[model samples]
Every structure is written in structure tokens, then in C-alpha cells.
Target: TQLLEQSPQFLSIQEGENLTVYCNSSSVFSSLQWYRQEPGEGPVLLVTVVTGGEVKKLKRLTFQFGDARKDSSLHITAAQTGDTGLYLCADLTTSGTYKYIFGTGTRLKVLA
Candidate 1:
């Protein structure tokens, strides 16, 4: 079994400020998915980066995979005040036995 630990459990920044959230693990995995979860709602998958130097971007957010496939990061640029709720990262492995894990989650509060 493996665990995904997210850093900066809470974030508070101005609307124009930029920030980065990280989800790290000690064990390697197959794929890592980044999710954005709003209050009273299920997590929405932003992007998934397969093992290697793959990167995916959506609007103001960019997701990157570690070269070793054991870690991932999410960068938000020019964040807006409306960016509320929380963000979570999950990983899946398809070797030996299937495993799925979710990060502790990072709550973001963008101030106007």
C-alpha cells in the first residue's frame, strides 16, 4: 500500500497571485491524476500525466509528472478570486496488483 501526501494543506492568496500544489509519494505508480473539488461537490479530474516527462495544461492550470513517475505538481497562474474549494491528486498502478490512492487535499482560498 502507498500514500499520497499533499503539501501546504491550506493556501491563501490574492486573485492575481500564482501558486503551486504538490502531491508526492515514495512508491512509483502508473499514472497520476489531478482533481479539483469544490465545496459540496465531487472532485473533477483536471488532467492525468502518465509516467515520464509528460505535461498537460488546461486554461490557467498546468499539470506535470515527475521523471520517476512517483510525484506530480499542479501550477495555477494568475489565480482568480473565484478559485475556491479544494484540490486533490490520485494515482493508479497497474503492476503486480492494482492500487489507487488519493492525496490529503489542499484547500485554496483566493482573495479579491
Candidate 2:
């Protein structure tokens, strides 16, 4: 069974702080996506990395895909209260069971 596991299920930080979250899996993925969701709203795609050793950035956020294609990471620089939300990582599985398997999730609280 393919599964995506995320580290630091919860995080609390003050404004301007830096934080990093990790997503890991034993199985390789064709593509991986990161999303951020706010209360009562659907998740918004933050980044999608397909190739090994690929990296992408969005403003203060950075995303990296592992060379093995089985892991990924997200780093946030100068976090603000506006960054408070749930971060989710998803990997496409080949089993045809589900299109993607989402991480348990990370709840972030950025204090202003």
C-alpha cells in the first residue's frame, strides 16, 4: 500500500519565523502536489513537482522533490498570520484506487 506521511502534524510560530514540513513515502510517485487550505475553504494548490530533484517556489514558500521521487518538503520563510492554515501533501498512486493519497496534514498557527 502506498501512503504519504507528513511530519510535524502541527506547528505554532510567530510572525516572521521560518518553518519546514516533510512528506515521505516508500513508493515512488509520478507527481506530487502541495496545498494550503483555510477554514471553510477548499485547498489551493501551492506547487507541483514532477521530476526528481525538482524545486519550485511561490513567494515566501519553497517546495522540493526528492531525487528518489518518494519524498518532498515544504519550507516557509518569514511566516505571517496569513500563513495560518492546513498544509497537505498528496502523491498520485498507481493502484487506481485513489487518484491521490493525502498526508495526514499539518495545522499551522502563525501568530501576529
Candidate 3:
């Protein structure tokens, strides 16, 4: 089984501040993804990184995949209250069943 580790399990910041979260694993994956979620709802996909060293941006958010494909990071610039939620990283495991494993998760609270 592949194990994923995420840093800074939680964050609380004022609007207009910035933060970064990370996900890492010992096993390499073919692709990696980031998601944002609100209470009582399923997570929404933010970005999928297929290539090592690839970076994708959406508004004030940026995502990056490690060169070894075993890690990823998400950076949020000038966060807004609307950005408060749960952030997650997911990757497919080598299990023949193709199981998807999610990271420990980062809970962000952006204060107004």
C-alpha cells in the first residue's frame, strides 16, 4: 500500500494572506491531483499534474508536482474568505484494483 503524508494539518489566516500545503509519498504515481472541498460536500478537483515538475495555476492558487512524481504542493496567494475549506491530494495506487488514496488533508480557514 502507498502512503501519503501531508504537512501542516491545519491553517488559519486572515483574508489577503498566503499559505502553502504539501503532499508526499514514498511511492511514485503516474499522476497526482489536488482538490478543494466545503462542508457536507464532496471535494472538487482543482488540478491534475501528470508530468514531474509541472505547475498549474488557477487564480491565486498554484500546484506543483515533484520531479520524482512522489510529491506535490499547493500555494495560495492572497487568500479570501471563500477559500476556507479542506484541501486534499490524491493519487492512484499500484493495486490491481486501482485504488485511489487521499492525503491526510489540510484544513484552511481564511478569516474575513
Please tell me which predicted candidate would have the highest TM-score against the true structure.
Answer: 3
Better of 1 and 3 by lDDT: 3
lDDT for each residue of candidate 2 in 1-112, tens digit (9 for 90 to 100): 8878998999999999999999998789778999999999999989889999999999999999999999899999999999999999988777866577788899999998
Ranking by TM-score: 3, 2, 1
| Regions of candidate 1 where Cα sits further than 4 Å from its true position | 94-99
TM-score of every model? 0.91, 0.95, 0.96
Error of 3 at 63 (Å): 0.4
lDDT of 1 by residue, 1-112 (tens): 6789998899999899899999998688667888889888899888888857788889999888888888888999999976777999988865577776788999999998
Error of 3 at 53 (Å): 0.4
Better of 1 and 3 by TM-score: 3
Worst 10 residues of 2 by lDDT: 92-101
lDDT of 1: 0.86
